[model samples]
Each structure stands twice: as structure tokens, then as C-alpha cells.
Target: MRLKSALSKVFASFVVKGIEKWKFDAVAAQERTLKKLVNEASHTVFGVDHRFVEIKNYEDFKARVPVRDYEDLKPYIERVVAGEADILWKDKPEYLAKTSGTTSGVKYIPISKQSMPEHIKAARNALLTYIHETGNASFVDGKLIFLQGSPVLAKKNGINVGRLSGIVAHLVPAYLQKNRMPSYQTNCIEDWEQKVDAIVEETINEDMRLISGIPPWVQMYFDKLTEKSGGKQIKDIFKNFQLFVYGGVNFEPYRAKIEASIGKKIAAIETYPASEGFIAYQDSQTEKGLLLLADAGMFYEFIPSEEYYNEKPTRLSLAEVELDKNYALILNTNAGLWGYSIGDTIKFISLNPYKIVVTGRIKHFISAFGEHVIGEEVEHALLSVANEEGIEITEFTVAPQVNPTFGELPYHEWFVEFVKAPVDLSAFALKVDKALQLKNIYYFDLIEGNILRSLKITILQKDAFVNYMKSEGKLGGQNKVPRLSNDRKLAEGLERYIA
Candidate 1:
């Protein structure tokens, strides 16, 4: 334990120094990263097509290559999948991360040997930075559990294919494996519930000091742990558990319930990692936003969210981004993704250190009645209502319900699965409706003009969202409920389980 603690301290010190140096000249660091990435891939098809050899700076690169989404890159990706080399990067990717697609069945994102360091190193640094910031080196002495996807990877044209978490799992350092719980066999369980059961059986009595996963799944694990431990809270079972490192979904809604389940407040660390790359992580205990990794093997571009859907949106380089504006993130990475849209939106909170808060997804919003409401707004409104009403929401989704018959006005329908139901359901609905109106002026106008009727709140049965996710074969890992949808597909699909 002493040796491990000493080693963790040394590593944490190194990471902190590295982060400080990187942030010392954030703009210069990003410019250097872009240059290196472009120069390395200069001979590739994409690089050559985009005049990479002549591209000496950010402006040149942007002028040469258009911003692309998954669909735009599909042709190049498909060619690579078919055994072609030097399509996007200098060589074919060693792995392909399959993600739940936004507009399609699935998205296969390339992952190269060169790109692996950014994902792995950034994640390691995030944890180490947290340890350094909080002086929690003892966390290294005890077991740390990462509730992730199966480690069993599939192959596609000789390339490993699986969830990014699963791929990263297979790459866990040998030293850390000693303190990591629930062996590979348990992690490889295909069924999420079965895997959670196996994990609980294996680590219920272990010296667990750290836990990492999406908030919803972690909450599920805590629930199971509490049930099996004769109703004992997680803190009672794992007395040493001190930190929760989570990503994939906003942790705000789950915070209250998760804290209650643990029976105490534990330090939490948040990360922003996507199939595209590991972008940022919470670097300060005092700050409320994540610090963008300027030296990570990716160059970032930001398009203002409001202007992104315009015919031609302005793209800003890292140095040009303004504070507190919602920007659609674009990436040009060593992994071979060039000028790619990751679909997530973020608002810069700090300029000197480049800190940001993820606002929402680009496509995840409702504007059916020209009352545009993004995921961030919906979440904020719901959170406000939850706090005021003294309720705990397990999960929720909202959709616009356009009346099929004449003489009926369209309205927003909210499906909420609560951990603790409010005393007055109608009053809770009224609060949420009023909160939404306050958040979006267009929504208020629609309500006032009778273009949209009052919001309807349907309290879902327990685990309705879970059941919905299970039905969709996405009950675990990185899958999450879209807070708001422009159409009725998700809302109608979840309606069946409404209480």
C-alpha cells in the first residue's frame, strides 16, 4: 500500500505539472497540435485532397476542408473498413469504435495507434489530476471499479470493433489491474443486469475506494448493492469509497439520489470523452467546468450553436472562441477524423485555461412550434422543478405532441420517472410548465398565443426508462435518454409504461 501510494503521488505530480505547462500557453499548444496532426497525415488521401501540404495554419486547413459529420465521412470510413489504407490517416485504423448512431443504426469511428494515447492518457491524467487536487492518493491503494461495456471485442476486416470503453478496458495498465475489481469475465457479461449482479457478488466486500461509470448505471449498481446488503447504503458496505468518476450523461439529476444511496457526499469527477476522442476533464475542484485539453492529439473548432444550422456558419478556432457561447464541437484528430462534427454543444466558461460546460447535443432539441428548447434548457427547467418540489427524478423525456384532429392545439408532453413522487402531481406539472415558459421566451409566446397548450406531465412507473432502454437493447454503457425530441417517436415509445 505504501509503495502504491508513493507511486500514485509521483504520477499525480507529473500529471499536474503537465497540465500546468499545457495551460501556460493554451493557444500555442493547440496550434502546435494542429500542425503536427496535419503534417503527419499530409500524405493520406484526405490530407492530400484538402491540400494539407500547403496548409500551414488553422485558417488554411479550414478553407481547404469542410466540416463533416458521420454521414459525410462514411465513404472514407467504408473504404477503410474494406481494407484500404491511407484513406484518412497515414495507415488504416487498428480499431473501430461502434457507437449508437444519431441518424442511423450505428456509427463506426476509427481509432488508431497514434490516437490511443490521447484517449488513454487524458483519462489517466483526469483521475490523477483529481487525486492531486484533492490529495486523495489513498484511492490508489484500494480497488477501483469502472462499470464499462464488455471487454470482449469483435473484429471487422481484421480491425477490433467494440465500444470505446470496452477497447480502453482491454488496455488497462497491468499495475492498475491489481487493484481493479470484478475480473474480465464479469465485465464481459453481455447482459447489463447480469453484469451488475456479477459485479456486486464479486466486490460487495472489497476495499473499493473509487467507482467510475455513467451516473444512471452507477446509481443502478448502488441500488442493487443497497438491496443485497440488507438495505445498507453503499457507504456502509464500502467504507473507503471516496470518489465517483463519471461521464456519458449529466450528473446533476442523479446527484441527489446517488448521494442518498451512498448515505454521504463523495467527491465526484466528470470527463468528456466521446467515440471521436477524449476532449476534456474536470481539472479543478473549485471550478464548475472542464478544462479543454489543448495538447490532446486533436484540434478543435467551434461553430456557434445558433448559427450552426444556418446555410453557412462561422467556425472559430480555439483562440477565437468567445466565453459563454454555445458552440457545436468539430474535431480534426490524429485518429483520422478530419473536421468532423461530434454533435455535442458546449459553452466556454473560461478563456485563459479554456474551460467549458457541455450544453447539449446538436440534434437533441424540440422546436415544433418555433419554441426552440435544447437539452440544456429542458434539464435546467426539470432540475429547478425537482429542487422546488422536493422530488427526485430518475429519468425523463419530453416531446411535442401535435394534435392529429382539428380544434386541438399542440402541446409539450413530458414523461418523467421519479425516484420520489411529489406531494402534489398537478402542482409539480404546473411548476415544470412555468419553468419552461420562463426559460424560453418563444415557449411563453406560444402558450400565450394559444399556439401550444399547457404542458402535460405523465409520471412513469418505476424503471420505465430502464425498461425502455432494455427494449431498445441499450440498457447499459454509454446509452442515455434524450431529454427532448422534436417528434413523438421516443415519447410514444415510452408512453406504454406511463403510470
Candidate 2:
């Protein structure tokens, strides 16, 4: 075995053993984390304002700090950005993870010195867990690429500001530096398409074994590779490629088309990472869910998805979460975010090790006529039919059509970009509609009671999602198209690209 591969095995064994200690006693670990975070931040501006000193337990913490989104926390964040110290956390944050926002224009999430290590460790441990579980450390000896944002960072009030992925790029371990591709100069390109082109030029002939990114961006990279190589499969281009590490979106929707482009099925690791924290990762190949990071520097809370918008939603800790129920995930992190809502909804699949699957975004859902359809349900419904019928979906999104151009009942409108279109499009759409109705009962009732017509599918031209994302200036680097939207903003924008 190569030196790096042997070292990876030893390191992975150690990491996995450490993780196992916290896996079973997750509740205890979370209790300790909450206590530590509250105690540490008691003197900070936000902590003092929220009376964190009196927060002796989860109930007290809940009473002291209410769930807040970026907008609600913007006051403190602005203070921090203006060179304020001891505001959110004990001291000024080391970095600000800048992200585009819906109403706020731009969001700057603090990454404190204390909390930043957890982010790096979680990502490393994810790989270590994979190595430990599968005994596949050979990928360590080969080239690995993470399709990400430019590593070039801007400064805000003497603090580094960049995308989370770009921030992570600077933190990659020195040991992996030689194995990592493409070069720093190539990674510094700001334009995503141009960056991918540069990446293809740099790494096309290298022995690539592991590729990591959000699925859509990785798909674009694969497309570029094939086009450049005159339609050769990715597996043909990189014969030793074995592992795909991805996060930000569910891999299932892109699995068929992605694997087809690669020309083979390969091992994949699903991770649940966010600017707020590294939440979870697939701990086992045989497991159905990602293992929640209880020992991480964040205290987690969950409110039932149905009660999310209520005056006072029921907030439950890790101990109180039940299996298979949708909940809007809330966070209180050492980075000094108190009762922060990252907007993602998740479902616990295992209570034992606290495993979860991201269900949808709290704001990204369709409830046009009381049929509250989530991202997971729609993706599941559509992908089920597609997989069963041997059709390949490149991308899809759904929105409710409240008003029709003609004298027809309103219905759910699905805009789909397919790699392989079904032979009978109408029948295929009906089958998918049936599958969705099964997943969400309210949707079934709406269809049965004639409140809404059956869902309609609008075939989209190739690269429709790409074009739409580009128009929105969200073409790459952790930008994901919502599977279902409560409004027609995304749907109407995509209409221009309809086939």
C-alpha cells in the first residue's frame, strides 16, 4: 500500500472510534454542547440581551431565545460587520460566510475561531468514516476535485468574507494538498462556467478518484468533460474514479443521469453541511439516513413543519424528536447564532444514532390549496416514476397554477428537463401525479374533490435549469433549485425555456 493510503487507514480508524463514542449517547452530548455554548456566550451582546445567564436548561433556553431567521438576526450581524467585538460571540468572528439572500439582499454569517475547527473536523471525519466503513483508502493516493466557489476572499471590516466552500478551500489539510485539483489559480476563477472549463483543462488527464460538489455543478463538470472528450464517458476519462462526495442537495434526483454520464455506479457519501454548521453525514453505506453531529459545536432544536409559522411553535431538542416526522431545524451554535433557523426542514429516520434526512426548505413548498407538498415528497414522487419507467431526469421543479389562461381548473405545474423523455409524456405525468398524491394525502383530496386538476408537466429544453439559474445569477457554488415553490416565481422564470 502507498504511504498516504496506509496513513489514511490509521487516521480513519482513530476518527471512527472517536465518533462512535458520541453516536449512542447523543442526547448527553447535545446537553453538554448546549450548556457549553450558553455559558461561553453569556457575556456577549446577544447573550446578555437574551439573558443567557439564566438559561439553565433547554426549557429556559427556549424561553430566553426565540427562533430567528437571518432577517431577525440582521441587527446583531450588522453590528458585528461594523467592527463590533463581543457582539454575537465572546469575540469578533474570524470569518463571515457571505451568501445571497431573498429579502435581505446579502447575508453574512459569522464563523468564530472556536466554531471553525468543527467545520473542518466534520468534513474530515465524514471521509474518515467512509474509509473506516468501506476499507477504501486508496482514493487518498489519487487526485480529488471539489467543484467550488473561488477561493479568493474579500474583506469586510478586517474580516475575511467568502462563500462557505471557498472558505473551506483554504482550510484543506496540507497532507491532501498534493492530491487536490484543480490548481489554486484555476480555483480562483470567479465565473463558474469558465472555472469548469479551466478545471477540465487542468484535470482531464489526471488520475481522478474522488469528486465532490453539489450535484448540479458536478453534473455540469461531467458534461464539459464529455463534450471535450468527444462524448467519452467520465469513467472512460478517469478509469480509477471510485467515490463521489456530495452535499447541499439530495443525490437521488441526479443519480440516474449522473451515473449514466459516468457509465457506472460508484460509491457516494451524502452530507448535511451548512454555513451555520456541519450537521450530519452518511455514517454507513447500509444506513438510510445521515448521522447527526450531536457532539459538534451546535445545539439543535426542531419545530414540527406544520407548526413552523405558528405564534409559538413547539420546539423540541434532540432527545424529543421522533422518527419520520418533518420538522424545521433550528440551531444555537458556539459561533453565537441563538435560535437561528437556517430554513431547512428535516425528518429523523433513526432516533438511536439521531440520523436524519433533509425533507425540504421551510419556505420552499406548495400549499396553494392546503396541499402542503414538500421538496422530498415531490422529488420522491417524480424520481419513483422516472426510475421505474427507465427515464432519466436532468432537472425538475413544481409550482401551483392558481389561475389558468383558459377556462380550466388550477393544478400543480411541473417543469421538467429530461435526459430521456418518456415515450408517452401525458401518461408519464399522470403516473408521477399519482405517486405524488400517494406521498401527500392533501394533494390526493384536492385532485379527488375536483378542487384542483391533475398535475401537468411542461417539458423544458436542455440546460433549462442552468439557464434559469444563470439568469438569477445563482448558476453554481451551492445554489440549488427548489423542487417545489409556494409561488410561481421560479416556474414563470423557467417558462421562457419550455420545449
Candidate 3:
């Protein structure tokens, strides 16, 4: 392992001063292209673009190409599988970003040749954020920070045999400084142990000011940092490491405790990215609230929560979204996932366009005995239960678990890491169960307990959830503790109690 002596640390601190600063800067062409993407997103369907040049205007485009869900594109994707790439757009796909789904094996999502630039742009934006927050830029010249995401691989047939991380890793800008760590591609993910080992060694002795990756992986990095340093805490170890960046899903459950363990309120950035594109980012000032990259190579639309389930959702174009409204995000990217619903639920936070907060996944819900619960409902119930119990829940995950006696019913197991464990589990369960009942009056009576007593709470010590992830081999990279379990197979995989 590379070791950073105290002098090396001081010298590295001097090096940090020369790194270049990144501002949220772009050229006029970038802005024009972004606007075009948004406009195209607002107007098209089934591989056609500039569909409403005949419509002659923006509002007419909105009236024609309503926001759509993934299922709506099933036909187009099927056509792609049949060797027709033009069903959605004109580009022949450079590659497909494979995303797993419960109903399907793996969706070979066609991301266009043009999508690579957005990845670099999002990265620069994230880097810019670090410079602004830390006041450190080429602003100094130490080892460049590396985002430890997944790696890429090439097959005998010349097709990439790895994830999106692998593909993007191959596309790293040659212009960046050499002080940076290995690209996700070169890290060689297929050899997991070796990949992790290399990252651990590099992180221990290097000057890494900004680290970007999935939250679980970053957490694992800190844990490994401690282990590599012969049990020194991360706070004592990564003294020069200023900010830890993350994206994908909610960091709410782990935020307070992770910060506590890091021994400082580490500046945290939550981003909204997908296989389709880096759709948005959380501002340095906003924290959890994300700002849509409205000017990126994508057109965006938001359909009201009520209309999300309808065959035709009422669409709000990028120029039309409002504050505090629950909307399902729809996208039209340069990659050609036109009118695509990423299936995330975000609430608009500001009206000038692009300011939003990702509230939760569209399907991240718990029914508590077939009540058809949603994320908002779960958050509400959790808060109600916490308030009633005079406690605060720091970590929790809700899923459907089966009990033979109760048959197949959705259960919200409150695995809480609290400030203090509450005395009354029954009352806490009752409080949550009651709020759920407000959503579905039939649930209480449907269950024998007359209050859906299946709901339960288990208090945990801080770091318990992180420890669980470590044991599960899901501690790092592009994995999350699956938030909703529609069926037992995947649900069983995330159920830590059984193991």
C-alpha cells in the first residue's frame, strides 16, 4: 500500500493549489443544441424528429407529442431488436446501456454516439461544483481525483462486454492531468477483488480532493480506508479529501450517520443520472435539490402525478414546469430514448426552469397489506410514527415481506437507526399503520389485527445498514438496497433478516 507521510501530505497540499477550476460555463452552440433537444423531446414519438415543423411552434409540439413511459416505447425497442434502429431516431446506436428490470432480463438500451459528450460535461459540472465549494482548483496541482465507477471491456466481436461505466471509462478526456487515478474501464471490474484492492491502495496514499461514485461504493471506500490504515478512522485518514459526491438514489437514510463517521459535515452532492443521460445535478448550495440540465442534449417533460398512470398523460414541457408539483420525468436525449420516462418522481423547487428535487422512485412504495402505498405515503407514515414515538428514524427501507400466517401481504419493516431507540414498537407500528389506513380504509379491516399489525420496527445501531451492505457484496458500485419488492425473488435478495 502507498503510504502518505506527514511531509508528503504537506507537499500534496501545495499541489492541490494548481488544479484548474471548472465553472458552469458553456458555449452558445451548447445552449442552442440543448434547447433543440428539449424542443425535440416535446414533439416527437416513434423515431420521428422535427415532427411538428408542420405544427410551426412549441405549444403545438406539446399538444402533439405527450409525455410517455417506457412501456410506450416497447414497440420501438422491439423494432430495434429486429434490426431497425430508425424506429426512435436516425442514429445507429454506438452501444446500449443495459439496465435490469424485474419483468425483463436486461434491456439493451440504445445510447447514441452523441451521448458520450454529455457524460464528460456532467463530470466537468460536478468538478466545477467541487472547485466552487472547496475554493480549490488547478486552483492547485496535486493528484487528480478519480470517480471510482464501473469499468469497460471489449469482446472478441468488438462489442463492449461491460456496463455503461466501462463504456464511459473508455471515453475519459485525454486532456485531464495524469495525477488522476485509474479510469473505471482500466480498473477491471470483472476482477472485483483486484479492482477494489487497487482503488484502496491508490486512495490511501494519494491526494484525492473530490471522489465521485455510487454512495455505497464511496462508503465502502471509507471503510476500506480505515482497514488499510490499520483501523484509523476515515476522518483521520483522508484529511485532504474535501468533498464526497454521489448520485442515483436517495442518500437520506445514510446522510447523517455517514457524515458523522467522516467526522465532518462533508459537502455532499446528489445527482440524477441514468443510462439515458446525466439528466440533472444538485447545486452546491441546494444539497438534495437537483437542477435539471435543461440545456443538455436532451429535451425534458414532466407529467403530473395524477396523469402518470393515464394512457395519455398531460405533459408540461421544460418551459412549463412549476414549483412543488409532483411529476414523472420524461426525456428526449441525444441517445434517442425519446419521450422516455426514467420512472423517477421529482418535485419542482423553483419556477425559472430546471430546479427540482427527486422525491423518490415512481414505484418505491409499500402497501402494508395491499393498500397500494407510495413513497410520499411511506414518508408521511414514517414521520407520523416517529413523532408519536418521540424518536427520529435515521435509516429505513420499506418492502413487501411474506409471512405464512398472513399470506402474501406488503409489510413495511422499519429498520431504523435512531438517535435513541423508542420503547414502544407496537405504538410506532400502530402510528404508521394508521397513516396507511388513511390512504386505504379497507386495509385495517382486511387484516385480522384490525390495524394491520404486521407492520414492525427494528431499531439498529448507527452504521448497521452500511455493515449490512458490506456483508452483501453490494457495498460498492452501481447497486442499491432495492427500495421496493414487487415479487419475492428480488425481495428475498434484499431481505437481510433472513440471512
- In lDDT terms, which candidate is top? 2
Q: Distance (Å) between predicted and true CA of 105, model 3?
A: 1.9
The full ranking of all candidates by TM-score, starting with the best, is 2, 1, 3
Tens digits of per-residue lDDT for model 1 on 81-130?
87789999978898999898968678899999998878989888888888
Q: In model 1, which regions exceed 4 Å deviation?
A: 404-406
Candidate 1 Cα deviation (angstroms), residue 380:
1.0
Worst 10 residues of 2 by lDDT: 478-487
Please, what are the lDDT tens digits per residue for candidate 3 over residues 142-192? 454444446655442233445676577667665454556664444765544
Query: Which regions of candidate 2 deviate over 4 angstroms?
Result: none
lDDT of 1 at 176: 91
Candidate 2 local lDDT, 8-72, one digit each (tens): 99999988889989899999999999999999999999989989899899999989898999999
Model 1 lDDT-worst window of ten:
401-410
Better candidate number, 2 or 3, judged by TM-score: 2
Q: How do the candidates rank by lDDT, highest first?
A: 2, 1, 3
